[model samples]
Target: MTISAFQDYLNEHRDRLLADLVEACSIPSVSGQMDACEQMAAWVEARLQRLGASVTRWETEGGPPIIWGVLGEGSASILSYSHYDVQPADPLDLWQSPPFEPSVREGKLYARGVSDDKGDLMARIHAVEMYQALHGTLPLVFKFFVEGEEEVGSPHLAPVAQAHADELKSDGCLWEAGEVDEHGRYTMYLGVKGIQYLELRVRGADTDLHSAYAPMVINPAWRLVQALNTIKAPDDRITIDGFMEHVRPPTPAEEALVERIPFDGQALRSRWGLRSWLNDMDDREALRQFVFAPTCTICGLRSGFIDAGTKTVLPSQAFVKLDFRLVPDLTPELVVELLRAHLDRRGFHDIEIVPLSSLSSSKADPESPFVRKVIAVATEVYGHEPVVYPSHGGSGPMYPLASGLGMDSVTVGVGYTGSNLHAPNENIRLEDYFNNVLFLARLLQSYAGA
Candidate 1:
């Protein structure tokens, strides 16, 4: 089938497609909200059914449902993964419009989930429909694996993938999200880093103490600060004993790829309101560290007397949330073990380690057939050559379903650098949405022919 015919169909139904996306985004399917998540899943199930897909809704034990849909029939099949859940739109005052109320301004659609996953999900659906309408039948089988718990670290996806291995296997998988960089080059990622999110707690006195007792009382807040300092050094390197030994260095090929990546450090610094990157590294070093190095990040910290007013009370207990972004060979269990031992050796056994959630890192060969095909199709669609990343800095549940299954996955979506993902006024450009539909249509055709 001709690509223009598919593009024409999408153009003709552009209004309806936008309406569908707006409807999908209107549901505030925040990750932990059971009612909203269920409603969104039902809506997706019905929409898939209407598009002639045989849908199966798998109910999770404590998490939301996993909507699996299969459509068309052919020897070749493609698995597409997306999520219906969104990050909580907290600090609502920052939003110009209600987070659940979809609004478009200056050619961009704004909503909490508009850019993260819903936009990518709806664009793929529209592409499939457009392809079928133009060709009279789907060229290959297409599977939709939309989950409702991705925003919460996809806590249930690994087990679900194991249970449905036979059905979930595919020739290749298209990951949830991607973006066109500020330089107009579409970006594709082959894998993601791993995550170990945890918390450290310390308790001293039974209750808050007066300033007069500060010299006698062991302040938990001070203990937390000392413990945090031990994890990272002044040079911005992880100082957790034995933690760096597990971080697998990038291969020669991976290092070469990073060198070729177009990283505008000045632009990034300006956007972040920073004078320089970590350790005042240049573009090449900064990009290398970003893609290959594991990190110890302090996500949040809390204790008493954090309010606006000043109080002379000393906090009895203190806690801090930390996330360790792991590279290859560094598993979450290993991190926890290393951290516990490190703290014990430092005589900080009074501090407690609370492991929250984790996901292992995943990577795919950038030169694989499926990956090359995606790069080729993206080049043809976007005109400019696509910027390929061997692995993204962010972490996701890509390991269990993609790498663990011995299948390669690549990320492709309809977002731009300006898309305020996980923040207020999250949005995507209208033009990018249409372009992504066309890109997906062409990708389907190309993969089917191959």
Candidate 2:
């Protein structure tokens, strides 16, 4: 079909397209909520089938099903990946509306997965539908693998990727989740950093003791604080042994791009309600470290206290959640090994190291021809210069795409900066939603024209 015809079709059915997206978003497909996982997958499968593609629900013994759909017949196929699931909605009271209700207010559609993933997935589907309605066929071959476990660390995706490597083969694959910059500039990202998430626990007394016995019984919370101190210094530099050993220095090209990137540290701090970054990380250094350096973060902590007022009780156990963001060439396994060694060497072998999730890093060359196509299309749609990220700070299951399928992945979507991703009041602007539909349509048409 022709691009103009497809655009006309999309505009003619704009309301219908928006309604379909809303219906899909209405499904509460939180992967953590196991029962809803299957329902969401079924909805996606049906939607793809309605779009004239053959659908398959690839099943795992205990994991949620992986929905797949295919269209057209060509050697060059685009593999589009998205997640049907979303993070659990906690702190419910903070939401302006019920998360699952899917309401529109002030030009924003409020829902848990609206911007994070479901919106992006719907855009591609709508694009395909528009082209089919116009020309009775797609511009290129297409395949979609919508996963159900992204919010929960994507534990089952590796096995799924390995098992269906040949079936999922394609010339290029787009990562599921992404967002525009604070200045309303469209940005395309290639690959993501690796991650090692672990929880540390310290034990002291056998049971909780009263305040009067504070001097006699040891405090596990204090011990946890002390251990955290050993892990990261006041300046945020990780003191863990061998943590920085595998860091690959930025290439001359990457360094030059870093210099070109317009990073406003003061603006970022104001957005996050912070006075300054840790250790006075100014604009240039902050952007450089965000892209290149590894990190150690304490996500959460638990200890003893009172319900309403202060209760001085020496807690028996204290727990802390730690995450390490890794750069290229550093696997999660190696980070864990180094963490264990660091603790053992520090004479704190008693502290338990419980792993939560580990993902290896993934990256693609920003200067590649395929990457330029992505940037060009994004700019055409958004009417702004698209920022090309060599690699983002977040972690995803993109390693297999880069290593197993031998294809670079790019993340481009309509999510705005204030979408409150993975948090309450999550939303996407109405304009972005419509723009994304146009972007996907133009992207598919670009290949045909090329």
TM-score per prediction, in order, is 0.92, 0.90
CA-RMSD of model 2:
2.8
Per-residue lDDT of candidate 2, residues 1-450 (tens digit): 445665677668878877887898888888777789889999999999988889998887687988999996655578898989988878899999999898989988999899878999998898777666655677578888888988877888888888889888777787776677778777777778999999998888788788687787778888778878888887888888877778888777667667867777888789789987777777788888888888888898999884897876778889999889988767889888888898888788878889888999887776666667777888777787677667788888888755457787889676888899989999998878777777787787775553
**Residue runs of model 1 more than 4 Å from their true location after superposition:** 90-94, 209-219, 303-315
User: Alpha-carbon error at 45 in model 2, in Å?
Assistant: 0.7
Which residues of candidate 2, in runs, are more than 4 Å off? 1-4, 90-98, 208-226, 303-315, 448-450
Winner by lDDT: 1
Provide backbone clash counts, one per model. Answer: 0, 0
Give the Cα error of residue 434 in candidate 1, in Å.
1.2
